[model samples]
Each structure stands twice: as C-alpha cells, then as structure tokens.
Target: METNLLFLWGTPRSMSTAFLRMMLERGDHEVFHEPFSSIVVQGRTVVGDHTVTSHDKLLRLLEERARDHRVFVKETTEYDYLSTGGDRIPYAGRHTFIIRNPRSVIPSHYAMNPAMACEEIGYGNQVEMARRVLAATGERPFVLEAEDLLDDAEETVARYCRHVGIPFLPSALSWQPGDQKVWSRTSQWHRDAARSSSFTRSEATYEATVDSDRFLYDCYWHHRPYYHVLRKWARTTVAA
Candidate 1:
C-alpha cells in the first residue's frame, strides 16, 4: 500500500477537473489529473518529468512519489479503464468519488462529444469502482455530489478534507484564472473551469437534452441507477 496517497474517482462532466484545480491550489499535495485517461487517449502521458507509457508504469510512478509527498490523483472511470484485465483500481490509497445527475451529465457530455457512448457517461463505472474500493478497504469511499459541491463549495470541500484526513484549506477554494498544463489534453472540455477562480455553476446550455436525443435519453436511464447506488454513500451536509 502506498502511504500518503489519495484518489478522487469520478464520472465525466461531474466538475472533477475543478476539484483537481482546487487540489493544485492547496500547494500541499502532488496532484495528477487523469493520468489513466492520458494513457488511454494519447498512448503516453507525462507525469512530472517521466513519460509514462503503460498502466503498470504509471502505477509504479505514483507509488514512488507517494513515498515523499502526499499524492492526490483525480480521474474518471470512462473508457473502460477499469475493465482492462487484473484488478485495476489501485488499492493502496484512500478512495473517494464525485457524481452528478445524469440529466445534467448526459447533456453536458453530449455537447462536447456528440458520438458519446453510454459507458462514457460513467455512473456504472463509478459504482463498480466504489464497490471494488470498499471490498479492498473495508469501508465505503467518501462520495460527493456535484450539486452539493457547486451549492456550497466550502462546506463540501471542508467535509471532504476531513473525511480524507487533510486540513480544510479555505484559500484553496479559489485560484487565479489560467490554463493548467494538466488540462491541456482535454482543453476544450475544461475552458470554463480554467477561467474560474472559484467553484461556480457550469453555464453550458446544451441543445442535446434527454428530452430531445434518444441516445442521450437512453444513456441517462441506463446509468441512472448506478448514480443512486453511489449517492447512497455521499457525504451528508454539515449543520450550520
């Protein structure tokens, strides 16, 4: 098990990139943004100074970094990254998750990639990943709803920091607006996030709604149940 390692696994269009950006702002942990997706989408990914070309090598690199730094990795379960052969979920770290309503997730995703496959919506994969994390860790991984995150960013993030055994950094809730190198590969999908200094609601109004697109409608219903399954364990609101 890699000590000082943490993971935030999530579904697509779930505001996870924003979450990672906050982690980057904290300046306390070494962060990786979708290292798995980088490999799957572009054949190779550069982690720090190392060029990681395979899943095994990437895992090894993360393990090495965990020895000296508190490592935070944020990734989505899209593209069947979890389905590739032997136990893919790195069981060494504390795992957490974030999710959004499919009604919102589907439409937002469709706008970015009209050819979006049902699996790319990601709730099903999240459910499976959570189960695997629980089986390995003997506890349900902390879960966050994107709605809650956007509604009360401070409270949600503070709760998450407590759950993961880190100090709540209020200042990390905001950052200077700029493009991050980590988001360059998926720049188009993250422009809004890069431009924001704080957690704000996504303003992308999509023409591809569940009401209008049969594919998106079907995809929503197909993965909606899994969303509920994970939501069952989502972090509860703290009392004022």
Candidate 2:
C-alpha cells in the first residue's frame, strides 16, 4: 500500500499546475498530472506515457509505485469523481487543496472553454471533495490560496512542505521553461505555465469580463460561495 500518496486538488485556472511544476523541480516524488482525469473526462486511461484503463487499475498502479517511490498527484476537481460516492479514493496519505477567486477563475475558464459547464467553474466540486476527504481522514486538507502563493512563492511552499511533513526546497520554486510530457493532454490550458520559469502572477482584467459575459457572470456567483469555503481555510501571509 502507498502511504506517501499526496494529492493536490484544485479548481480549474487556480495556478495549481504551477505548484505541480515546482514539485517536479524538486526531483523527488513520482508525480502524475491529473491522472484520474483521463478516466473521468476523456474516457481513456492515458497518463503521460502510461495507460491503465480504469480508475481501479490506475489507483492500484499508483499504490504499487508508491512502495518504491513517493507519489504526488495534481488534479482539478471539476469532474466530480469524488462526489460519485464510493470508497474509490485512497485516503491513506495526504490530501491538499488550492483555490483561486471565482471572479478570476470563471473568466479564465471561459477563455479556454467557452462551452464549460458551471460545475467546471469547479469551486463547488473542489470544496465537496475536501469535505469528503476530511470526513474520511479526520483531518482538514491543507488549503492554499493562489494569492498567497503568488505573493510569496518561497514562504507559501515552505509552509505547505511543513504541513505535509516534507523538506522545504527553495530551488523548486523556479524551473526551466519547456513543455512536459505529463502536460501533453491539456497543453493549451497551460500555455503560460509552460513558458514560465517561476511563479509570476499575471494581471487579469475583469473589467470587460463577467459583466460583459452573462455566462461567466452567473458562473462566478454560482461558485463564489464554495470558493469562500476553501478560501477561509487557505494559508495566508496575514497575521492571525
């Protein structure tokens, strides 16, 4: 059984990929980028170069691999795999989450997938999964706000490492700019991240966004409450 399986779940456009890139730079842990997403979204088993064909098989593969290596997984929670209700998840290791403002998330998501469903706005599913993980594990998943990460990449990641009982590696914050095979399935969504060498927050304009687009406007309100649910628990630089 894999005891070091760490999951980093987040909503779409939440800067979660950038965080995963940092993990890859760490040179430790066997990382999988949205591995379960193939089964849920594409109906395939492709995860980088491997194809396990089913959630059960994929989970087992991860478990088996964890015996000899530390495993880290980063996934967007828009698919509701966690909401389906079952013992499908391996609750043994750590489950952590990251969230971004829906005001920002909705517009960015619309830019990529205009046909995206409200659920794909994702804060709702993200929070629901966190709740389920909490119920199963008896521990609230560590939540990181994108703002905090962008504000201080070094400190935020250091905090995350401590919370998960891992060593803090300042070198992981920046990496070479290139396309990684693990990101092959959804390269377009990660264009900026693919070119970025570090955590640099871009200026996202909302002026002509939600107000001009009715769909995104609704999406923001629909998921804003859920975003706050996770946001309240996220690590911030503010003093308690």
lDDT of each: 0.84, 0.80
Cα-based TM-score, every candidate: 0.93, 0.91
Off by over 4 Å in 2: 46-50, 83-86, 204-208, 235-240
lDDT of 1 by residue, 148-217 (tens): 9888999889888887889999999999999998788888888888899999987778877998988888
Can you give the lDDT of residue 170 in candidate 2?
A: 91
Q: Indicate the residue-level lDDT of 206 in model 1.
A: 80
Candidate 1, clashing residue pairs?
none
Native-vs-model 2 lDDT? 0.80
Best by TM-score, which number?
1
